[model samples]
Target: MITVVGTGTGAPLPPDAEAAVAGAALVVGARRHLAAVRLPEGAERIVLGPLAPALDAIARYFDKADGTEETDGQQETYEEKETDGQRGGRVVVLASGDPGFFGIVRALAERFGSRRLDVRPGVSSVATAFARVGLPWDDAVVVSAHGRDLRTAVHVCRSRPKVAVLTGPGSGPAELGAALAHRSGARVLVVASALGDPAHERVERVTPGEAAARDWGTAVSVVLCLDESRVLAPVRTVAGPAAGPDRWALDEAEFAHRDSMISKFEVRALALARLGPRLGDLVWDVGAGSGSVAVECARFGAAVTAIEKTPDGCDRIRANAAAHGVEVRVVHGAAPTVLSDLEDPDAVFIGGGGRELPAIVTVCARRARRAVVVAMAALDRVPAVRDALDAAGFACDGVLLQSSRLAPLPGNVTRLAATNPVFLLWGVRPPARTEGVPQ
Candidate 1:
């Protein structure tokens, strides 16, 4: 059987796990793990560099471990080793705390079946960081930026009130801070570095700007981004992120819009369907009349930025966001010009851009990672917007949405009051490229 021991993070390895490492015929770990352990005399060691190489090395031992085949140039086979009063030759993979928790355990388990693995888990760095900060982590959203795009971490930080980001090279705290600095200044970042080490461990709280200004070395364990006011939430019965809003396409009366200028409920329903906003996604609502679309997107757990040329509209967006108990970054500037400063969105909703509709769609479509949904009144602008989306190489589809509401006339009689017709157009980047990777 292959034994996997989780170490590092300041905790001493358990006696059983240590003994497993000592008995390992072929030991595999990083430099630090190897240095910390006391290996049995003349045990084969593989210092991890590239993952495939290490897995290949481990496979060699497993192939011969059954004692059915000759050893890899070794004098004795596993049967002989076991008969000589030693445990049958087996592999031990050392990894950081809770290797199963977004660590090396997955690779090991995938390569060598779980049935073959005797896993001993240590406290994960995420747990250590949260413990250092003295907060309950059951409510925190944890994401790994290691070997993945930093944008996912950034968006999680933007959307959630609490988040723990596992830092990796190029996707570390500095990179995360720079991405969040301009957009989410209200958040406080708790930078936890070298956790579990008494001499070098640090848990410092800094603003996104302060974090961006520094060069944090490779010791970072995790970064906690929090909106302090909402960090302490009610006890969570269900773990991971909070659930998405139970209801969407909220009533128009729910939002504070300017003289019924918001995207009507019917238009919003289809627009939201096209924009598939969810956690870890960045969504833009350009020309957000009252940020109805933006607020709705935020309710679904997507990080939203509402761009409006009017200051009052910006305030309304913020107010609407606050009223809905969601966060929406409100940028008070016209689209097609102001969108340059904001980060690329996973999805975008164009509500009202007037003559700038085509230009706005063109800009948003090019940068949107997944889809772009546009809602318009003028029939003339639909062709231009479609052209722009087509130019951006999106698979464009649309519908003319016309709905009627129940109107109370006289004596409890009902009439179908036809709302103004709206053109709802959506452009989806083909599924092959829709997985949030920028083109």
Candidate 2:
């Protein structure tokens, strides 16, 4: 039998839990974890460093009892059985904080199914750290930077203002502090360490720069309280493109393009409606001329990918993106072919395709979560796009946009100049399942 014990937040195991751990013949865990516990006088202790050797030790214990020779790759056993001599040995695994939440208990279960082990949990570091700051954890986003990539953590902090990051030695407050320091806007960083222990946990409130300067203690978790009232820049503060004329689907003259080519403001507005760019969504703009739609979508906090064939168009898109101060990854290549190697997008927008509309839309509809196709009076291709959408099981809709902007004529008099009519077709993939939640 394997007993999983939590030492609490830097505290000793409870009396009853200690008894169970002490009675076990073998104890296995990190060196620090093993050193902290007083083994029941003669209990055999295993110091865990790297994962492979530690797991091999656990497998050996089971092999000795079952009278079975150890086999490579067949290292796990679920149920405990009786031994020949009627003497049953017990093995106890130690973990920090709550065993189940981002702890070693999960690894144990995956290796030697849940039936063979009994878990005893304690206060998690996240809970202890939050309690130190007097913050409610229910609404907080909890993420770990311990032995994991910081990309998701950085993205979470960028999107959500309130977040708690569980940090380890190298991945501690200093690293996170540095990330937030360079990040635009105002934020209050809280570093809490050695929580719930007699060491007297320290909670420091500092500016991102100040926090980055200090060397944080080991086993720290950082809580970032974002100041939303703080604005990143003048244009960025404006929430969405639909809020005003200047906020989105910018005027064609704003970008440098060949032959006055653009997606047209009217068509862009419709594309935004169908694409629904938001946080956690990925939208691809294929045949992106000026990247106006892609940039606008990024403002709404969606990850955007713009595919353009011409080197000039790609450069123009990047320049426009930097001007707006939003991220829009521009890939310099032709679509349908170029897009095959790209990550699957949540939605796609097709801006230019002479005869490739059907094949492009078909491929996008297959890989994309949703797709929008824009056409400029290529009447023969409309039926093909519609048929492709139908075959891909998408609910399709379309609208024709014909805008006449009032312009000053050569006689210094204003006149409505009719632009070419464009066809906008959109298709949305239905959600797999939905449970109604009150808005």
Candidate 3:
């Protein structure tokens, strides 16, 4: 049997785990974990660096006991041997924190079926880090940047108030801090390093700027990115992000806009539905005139970047975002060129594109993982936009929104004030088609 054990933050191993370790014929784990645990003099030890070799060795050891050699890439299992005064066929894999949570237990289970393996879990690093900070973590979002892209973690810190980032060599506190340095909102980055090691355990709180200035060598384990103001929210109904905003597609008057430049509420509601913004998603609002769409998406718990050409428009977007108590990264530059540096988006909303409408739509469609929604005031541009989306392998659909609001004239009489019509075109990437056998 393969037993996966969690060593919680340098604490002494539990009695049951200790007995397992003592009886293990093969103990596999990191150098640190192996050193901490005592093993029988006759036990074989494997220091986990690249895990494949160790896994192969473990499988071979078991196969030898069953008098069978692996061949043709096929798996073989062995029956437990009865040895006097000892457990002769036990294998133990050591891990940090909870073995089942983003740990090596998954690898072990995949190699050896779950029925043959047992898991012993401990407190996760995220839990330990929060404990060190004296904060409750039920409301926090946990993301890992270990051997994966850091963009998602960065975006989570950008939009959410509380986040615990599991750091790897290149994607640690400094990298996280540098990414948030230019954002409008303030964040406190708690760098927790060498967790569980009494001599090396350290939790340092710093601003994004301060964090970027230093090199926090490689012992770091996790970083807690927090917006201090909202760290403790009113007793939550549900955990993680609050239930979607009480209201969305807010009226234009709620936002600060210039000369009625904001997209009508009707258009925004459809765009939002198509965009389907949610936690862990990054949405781009290219040509974010009043940032109405950006603000709304942020309200729905998506990270937003508002790209506008004019400096004034960027400022207006920021003001509207702040007024709504949300964070929106406003980039003061034109699209297609400026968009090259921005992170790829899950969904995109294009409110204005000037003569570069088709080009902008092409770029957005190429990068957007879900859907691209575009609003055009000019009737002549609809066909070009549609063509651009079609070229990008998107299923295109559109509607001309012409709404009229009730206006009070005189003597308690109301009249329908017609608003300018806008063509809303959206493209959804087709579900991947599967091939069938020929008849």
Candidate 4:
């Protein structure tokens, strides 16, 4: 059996965990964790670094627990021997905070089955950081930038009111702050370092710009990104992200657009389908005349950036977003040029770009990680759009939609009013596909 202890949150070692450590034939942990606790003399110690090597070391020590060479890489299941006044496992893995919460417990459990592990979870760093800020975290989004891409963390922080980011080397506060400083300056970052140690523990609040200006060393435990305005939300029965919108493709009248300049509900529905907006996603709405597409995408819980060339259009987008209770970063610039400064999006929606539509689509398709959707009135642009998507290695598909809505004439009579035909095109990255596009 293997015993995993979660300790770094200033909690005293549990009595059972103390006994486990005392009898452990092989003890594994990070350097800081090892320094904090006293191990039984002569117990083999493996300082955690690259996970595979530590797992291998644990396997070696467990294989020889009975002092016999087990033929296979199996641990000898001898009857429990009493040590430290109790029976214990042959291996103990020490981790910071709740090892079960994004810690070593998963790796250990996978190597040795859950049946072999006795997990003792402690307070996670995320919990501690939120406690320090005196905020209720049930509504917060916690993302770990440890050994993973930082863009997801930035995107979540950009859209959500509360976020907790677990810092790692190269992906720490400075890097995260730099990424968010320009785009998410409205949010605040609380950097907590060396949790559980009274003498060395430090927690500081700073703007993304302030954090970007400093060199936060290796002690950073976690960074809490918060938008103070919406920190408190109504009680949530479900955890993680807020629930996705119950409905989408809102009617044109739902948005305050200029004389029906916005993409109609029919076209917006199919565009959103191909875009597949969700939490932790960054979506770009280029040529957003009324930002109706941008507002709808934001409602789906994605971080949306609406690129509009006209100053008035940008204002309309921002106002429309505020009215709908969603955050959308409106960039008052044209696509294919302003797009260079913005982060690559998970998806892009290009609506009514005129002759520049194909060029914008090419640029967006190249940078979009998942898919791109374009809406056009002219069939002449179809070949160029298809070529752009194909050149960017996307599987291109499209549909031409013509719809009619009920119109009231004289004497309580209703007649179908034909809407202009629109061509909707989408290109998805290979092998991955999402559901639902309107006819």
lDDT of 3: 0.88
For all the candidates, what are their Cα RMSDs to the real structure?
3.3, 11.6, 3.7, 4.3
Clashes of 3: 0
Please tell me which model should have the higher lDDT, number 3 or number 4: 3
Residue pairs clashing in model 4 are none
- Candidate 1 lDDT by residue in tens digits, 217-241: 9999789999999889998899989
341 Cα displacement, candidate 1 (Å): 1.8
TM-score of each: 0.94, 0.56, 0.86, 0.92
Candidate 1 pairs with clashing backbones: none
lDDT of every predicted structure (CA atoms) = 0.88, 0.73, 0.88, 0.87
**How far out, in Å, is residue 27 in model 4?**
1.4
Q: For residues 1-439, write the lDDT of model 4, one tens digit per residue.
A: 7888889889889898887787876789999889878899877788999999989877755555544446566635554444444343467889998998888878887888889888888899999989888998988898989999999999999888899999899889999889988886379899999887899889899989899999988999799999988899999999877888899989888888887788989998888888999888999999988899988888888899999999999999989998998899989887778889988899999985777888898899889999999888999999999999999999999999999999999999999999999999899988543567433
| lDDT accuracy of residue 196 in candidate 2 | 61
Let me know the TM-score candidate 4 reaches against the reference structure: 0.92
Q: Can you tell me which runs of candidate 3 are displaced by over 4 Å?
A: 64-67, 71-80, 83-88, 309-312, 334-341, 362-370, 391-395, 402-419, 428-439
